[model samples]
Target: MVEHGKGHPDRLAQGEQAITEVAADRLDEDGRHEGRLVLTPDRIYFLDNEHSSGGHDDVIDHTRFQGAEVTGDDTVGTLALNWSDQGKVYEGNTLELRTFKDAIDDQLNP
Candidate 1:
């Protein structure tokens, strides 16, 4: 069964492999949330520390992933994920953002 409320690695579904995970701040209209941005083969999960009490704050399936854009200075960057009708942004270390971009790009292409 697919786990919907937990944020830890143990919450991942069986046979689902994590491609990348990083400590980042998820940005939304309301505010920023500290969370782990986890990219798995089937979904992109924003596991927020504060908002994950009952349901997922954000979970984008691979088929819904449209594109990603990264922008920032030398030390930090923001990764913006674009999907069908919505988007999500995460701010974190520059290198980590690049890693996320690459992984997402690979998924989109392959």
Candidate 2:
């Protein structure tokens, strides 16, 4: 898992800036997979190291981001991202999830 506050700015497109990122367990119908959740100016995406082929495993444009829900406490938990018609859940440290949610909210409202 990605350490708290660590980010992958190099993964961004040219001129794209990263707000924050974290290492989390992506919970899918298939199972949980280790990946990094990245927040950029234009989108939030997951980079699944186990299956990556030089592209995001999944992406949600900022325009499609509805909101986020954090379940758990200060030590550990899950982060649920609400999108246009669906949502995604990621399990990680509570502090990192909260920070990521706050960053997304700030961008949406800023």
**If scored against the real structure, what TM-score would every candidate get?**
0.82, 0.83
Look at candidate 1 and give me any clashing residue pairs: none
Note the clash tally of each candidate: 0, 1
Which digits, one per residue and each the tens of the lDDT, describe model 1 over residues 52-103? 4626557788888888889999888999998887998889997878877887
lDDT of 2 by residue, 1-110 (tens): 34323455555566666667888888989899888888877988787878646453778888888889999977889999888989889999998888888888887889
Which residue pairs does candidate 2 place in steric collision?
A: 2-23
Candidate 2 — which residues are off by over 4 angstroms?
1-14, 54-56
Error of 1 at 103 (Å): 1.1
- In angstroms, the error of model 1 at 95 is 1.4
Q: After superposition, how far is residue 16 of candidate 2 from its true place, in Å?
A: 2.1
Reference-based lDDT, residue 78, model 2: 99
